[model samples]
Target: MFAKLPFRTGTTSSAIWQGFAGSVMLLLGSLGVGWLASSSVLIRTPLFILARTTPAAVICATVLLCLGALLMFRAWLRLSQHLSGWNDDAGPVLRKALILWVAPMMLTLPLFSRDAYAYIGQGRLMQQDLDPYTNGISALNNYFLLGPDTLWTEAPTPYGPLWLWLEHLAVLIPANSPEIALIPFRLASLAGVVLLAIYVPKLAARHGFNPHRALWLAVLNPVTLMNFIASVHNDSLMMGLVVAGLYYASTKRAVVGILFVTASIAIKPITLIALPFVGLLWAGSRAGWVRKFALWAATLGISMAVMGAMGAVNGLGFGWLAALQTPGTIWHWYAPVGIGSVSLGSLVDWLGGDGTPIADGIQKVAQVISILIVMALAFVKIRLGPSGGLGADLPEPQRYSHAVMRRMAWAFTAVVLLAPMIQPWYVVWLLAFFATTGIKDGWPLRTVFYLSAFFILIALTDQLSVFPWISMEVVRSIAVVVAVMGLLYLTLWDKKTSELFKRNKPDQHAFAVKS
Candidate 1:
């Protein structure tokens, strides 16, 4: 069925076949990973009886699983390349491919994060009339039934009121069956990805980019599939709403756009950064400075009112405001500011100074610097001009849309890089924006792709635990071998071989011409 779809000029029959084969391999790998690994919160399904138990079987499954993942990654790169432009026929094809790719994962256990279990627990808290923002999952006596990871057992929910209310609804359905309760949450995440698939292309086309390529980057990318869909992260819903809001705001429906963006903020407050950009998008070149100011003010006012109404409906009030700072307490190496703080602390200690205070000071400095940089960029984007100036000849709405997307991309990057606790999925915020605006074939684009692969490995390693017989040494060895082999195959054997043939073609052409 996929073979019949209309792709761009360069798409080959071989590429389609290859991608189908890779999807099959990814399905098997997902099954292996799901079967072998135990969930921290949920009970094992009856299907887990088929999981590899012996040393040899486990090792073989591990290798196969890694190979399948790499294969899936390669296939996506090929298929995305075939997606050259906004072909109307490509939409159904992309959706079909997405389903083929994601179907196997749905049958398997959650792939990367255990946040869904936490959501279940938080929802139970809300159902019990306990404010999730102020109370942790520990507040619920039957928290064990939900199987949330201990990391968040004592931590109050940092998510916004809209999410809390959604959690309430999720927990209320199929109340007796603990195992079945999680299906709703996963479906909700799936709904979010569906929204993204629809809006990303629309936004891309409006801003004069290849909507097909944008769909590939925003939806088919491993980061989106693994973190957003498989892991069922709330960021999926937030991003979906964000993209939809941006699309509406760009199309001159400023009121509708503000409401959507506000809803996203109600899911996760970090998206509040986009509110100002939306206001600016509504204030285009045609509007005078005074009108721009008034529009901005009106946008803020309406957004706040809508949010307040949502808060009242949920009965959660504004507790999420205090909860916003909750995530910053956790630190990780992936965060630039986090690692910097640790490195600075060690340096100060080595130099016979107080390390704790110095580390704190360094973190604050990094954060302040990032904020200032974002502010400067926003000011320049608003006062001066758009970054690429590609939309100068376009309509005012399209031009302003491109400008706001570009600036928002920068701001989102700053937020991710500077945050004390960074997750693999948070990068999607910047990626969704960039994919629509158009990524240049440069270092930044390359870096994003590289990071996607790197984070996949990191997430898999963290989530997929081997049996006791496998030994930590054997597991580490397998990981190292797989990483090296995958890197070599992808970079040298696959990509380099293509480059070599292309380079040699020119010489052959020159020789033929002379002859």
Candidate 2:
């Protein structure tokens, strides 16, 4: 257990015991999700000993969650008040372990327990040449014969072309048991992990942050591993592709970025948000108009072709053209934007979450707003290329320039915010891009990252039981939301961001530099 713990020092017995305790928590949090997924007496016995009712589960969840929140808050205050300094090395390390520790709590993802099975049942439909997008579980597969779980029997498929195609493909793996269904999907989620490992450090090193810190932040995020690996969400793969695209874009490989982001959009169209940043990169180039135009056009064309082929092969075709029609069909919190604005809009009626005339209208309005905002930023960047040569957020003195790396971080953030839904795994975008940013900017980046991870695990604690209460889930969700936002401010949005846009005018630069 201590082996996994990065910090520990003691003589003899105390050190040994502490190490053992740490190991146990880590293992239990990661693999112990079996409590909800499996009904084996072995798994249930201990939890039963701990507490049986929904209240007990809720209580346990509440206590740990609150404690975790306070711990994180303490860390934040320490950093913000200048009582302590993280430096480059220590800042990211603390964030890594905290984030990774959150993974096990996601075991509840399965134990909360409905979505994965619906994916199975839906995949079974695709096996029979049925369109899952338009159909429910009953269309291709019968419900009464399974383990009596609603996720398996009833939840509708809500994912898009790439996920549905993969879900359909996963069905062919020949499952002898329910766990086998989880096998391929879990393995598939590893694509994000691999990508994080391969690119985060490289991207970080390129941008002047410690590559090691960046690598740990992305590759080792618990929510990412838990949701994608244990929970089997596809966001990991989508995020991996998105970040890979960003990594390529940073290298001036706009074509590669386009192809990768296109592939991501096929998985989830929200990845398309990165296009503006990609466009920004194109505009940043010294290339002539024809060359820049050709690069942009070629990438867009190739991306569209890939999406079309993907849809065609999966029997989805251009059905996604109807995406605008089903505006409210997805969950709001499936992305960071959703989480950020959870309280801004009407409390979405879950049943009415399906697109209807009113919700559709509102969603369209919101979508348009997001577009206007993104497009406006990109448009401003175009002028920079033509007239200013370069904008700020450039490391030295720009008013607001993201550079290649900061651009990646901000681009990924926008991608998640504008996503159709917000899921826990969606944090991978943050995890991925955090690695690719410049120096820490005196923000407690690691501490915030750790805080977010703790709340995620606390949320998962409820999944340890059969009927985890909505009240507790709600409480946990709120705590997580607070933790996430607090962290966001500390880590990503702490400083004066306008500097990212352009260099201060010379007159102002003189004052600002000295100020």
Runs in model 1 deviating more than 4 A are 1-46, 49-61, 83-89, 142-145, 175-179, 349-354, 380-389, 442-444, 465-473, 495-515
lDDT of 2 by residue, 1-515 (tens): 00121222222223223223332343343232222334224334666435434454545444443343333333333322221222333334434443443334333324323456556666777888877666667764344332324433433454667777777777787655445565555655666666666676656555444554455445544454445554556677777787788667766687888877887787667676676566556445344666656666666777788888887777677666555333245545434444434433444554445334454455556567666765554443333333343233233312122354455455455544665564455566666666566434323453444544453544454343334433545545644665555445544554632122223322211011110
Q: How close is candidate 1 to the true structure, as a TM-score?
A: 0.86
lDDT of each: 0.70, 0.51
Clashing pairs in 1: none
Least accurate stretch of 10 residues (summed lDDT) in model 2?
Answer: 506-515
Worst 10 residues of 1 by lDDT: 506-515
Best by lDDT: 1
- Backbone clashes in candidate 2 total 25
Badly placed stretches (over 4 Å) of model 2 are: 1-114, 144-162, 279-284, 288-290, 321-327, 330-362, 382-421, 439-458, 461-465, 468-515
